[model samples]
Target: MTDWKKIRAEFPALENWIFLNTATFGQLPKRATEAVACHFARRDRYACSDFMGWFEDADSVRATIARLIHAAADDIAFIPNACTGLSLMMGGMDWKPGDRIVTLEDEFPNHYYYPGYLAAQGVEFIETPFERFYDAINQRTRLVALSMVNYSTGFRPPLEEISGFLRERGVMLYLDGTQGLGALQLDISAIRPAMLSVDGYKWLLAPTGGGFIYVDSELRRHLRPNIIGWRSHRDWRNHENLHHGTPEFGTEAEKYEGGMLSFGPIYGMAASVEMMLEIGPEVIDERVMQLAGSVRDILRRAGGVLRADSDSLYISPVVTARFEEKDAGVLAHELKSRKVLVAARHGNLRVSPHFYNDETDLERFEAALKQVL
Candidate 1:
């Protein structure tokens, strides 16, 4: 007995709105907010004192994230957002002229800009449908960038199948796990991607501006980040030493930590991720899929068209639907007027349910949508 109702009580916003837009932003849980407050309180009291404590908290959170993904703590690094995480990872790569990067069509734009930027440097960027990604990869492909789950259509790709195929050819896999990581069950260790980036705001139930990046250990050994600072050195504190020669950087992904981190957001994400871990990953997945299934049933009854096949092998916590004659943006606004929260992505009404959401919320959404329709 997980006491899901009690768990749902942790989020007070649900009392105000039927929140089904975990894709856009997950409501911050009380525990995470408290942790953030605690960090600010500490910072207010000690302006610059106990600097190592912040780093320790970051390391602790890093270890927690590693545990969540079944990776070594050394492989994880806290970042400002997934955008920077992707930019930092790919931007630092040793891309050569004529190298091709394969990404999905209609990604959330973070996946587009970097490869597009690299186009000026003679790097070829290819965008393909998720279903045809396997067919699009040719010999020139060096890295495959994609989201584990499509934010627009709640389209969870055949990640493992694709990863296995890429693994056979030694093509690096880069994943933006923002929409899939926390709400869904994924074994990062098993997938063994070269890089994975995630933001904590959505699905993870954390505050904004905090996220983590995972770089493969073997990749870390060979790749040198484009950006490095004082913190990049293993003995950064030894600057006051009388004589220091060549600086030795950390071999792990922590080397990319670069500089100071926002302790508040780190703590906030830690608290939220801990909550998910406490609830159990498999348990959360089951609850989310069950709710999403009910949402599909409701939309079907309301004469809304599902964006993807409900019976598809790949599905996610996100479900998108649209009335035949209704515009997704207008429908979203209509629902919001009634205190129902959903998102419009790629001209579809996207509703993402989490473990804490229950039947009451779903029923409210069904009634509101039916009345609107």
Candidate 2:
């Protein structure tokens, strides 16, 4: 059984304010903060001598992340952020002149504009309405990029269905999982996209500037690493070849990790992910969905129009709502003044709840909305 009240105590930020902004940046637990401090302390004491130990810790973090998403650690590569991973894949890899990429109209800028950048190079960019996203694919479509959950609306597309459709067409599916990875249960085996990237700060409860990318084993063999560094090679430690212009690349996802990782955030990521794992994804998903459902219900009762679709299968922890007459920005500001934090995106108020939030938080949010809106 989960001691949710005790779990909530681990996040000190919850004491002063009602945080509903996990969609923007998650509140780090004490464990994550302590882990970062410990990392810095060790680095301050031992300096470069702790470098190998950092690698060892990173490897463990990779394994933990892989376990979270039901993926193999060998397939995971640490990247700075989701955009960098996608950029590396799109820009670094070879693409034919006539290759087409399909994307959703409501996708985040990274998914929208990165493919558009390829348009100047003769690649065809096809953006269809969110409902028609899957139908936009054809024989010429080389890749279909989308977010697992729409950042603006919190609309979750049926990844398994879309991936299956793409698989039949031999087209690659690229997914940005920053919005849904930690708060929801993601079984990669059920929806095996060719490539997937996640920003750890938003949902994984880690510090900013830390995330990962996963390239399917078969796809990794075909991708050529454009961003290469000393660490990209199998014989990375060979001091004699360090200054040489020519070097052999590793045959795995590590080849794409250009250089030394951002260790501070990674240490936090490892600790936070370990806490999440100890709590269990299934438990987290259940609690998040329940809290989000309550939030939606209370907002509706408080005269807020539900903007996000509460699809039975794909509903996540993010709940977006709009007031009939009030502006989203004004409402967000009012909530902030009352210490009920939320995000205003595309004229909708987005409330993302994590496991730390409780009924009292929801009550405060509803009361604030009633008073302000």
Cα displacement (angstroms), candidate 1, residue 180, comes to 1.3
lDDT for model 2, on a 0 to 1 scale?
A: 0.86
- Per-residue lDDT tens digits of candidate 2, residues 1-373? 8999999999999999999999999999999999989989998799768587788788888899899999998888988789988887798668888899988776798987788888888999988876677677778899888888888888888888888988988998899999988899999989999889999999889899779998898888888787888787777755455746676776768778968889899888888889989999999999999999898888788777775544553356778878879999999998899998999999888999998999999988888888997
Question: Model 1: per-residue lDDT, tens digit, 239-307?
Answer: 465225555777878888777777788999999999999999888888889999998888888888886
Model 2: how far residue 33 lies from native, Å: 0.9
Weakest ten-residue segment in model 2 by summed lDDT:
307-316
Candidate 1 at residue 165, lDDT? 95
The weakest ten consecutive residues by lDDT in model 1 span 238-247
Clashing pairs in 2: none
Q: In model 2, which regions exceed 4 Å deviation?
A: 239-243, 308-314
Q: After superposition, how far is residue 70 of candidate 2 from its true place, in Å?
A: 1.2
lDDT of model number 1 = 0.86
Clashing pairs in 1: none
Which stretches in model 1 have alpha-carbon errors above 4 Å? Answer: 237-247, 310-314
Evaluate residue 122 in candidate 2 and report its C-alpha lDDT on the 0 to 100 scale.
91
Cα lDDT of all candidates, in order? 0.86, 0.86
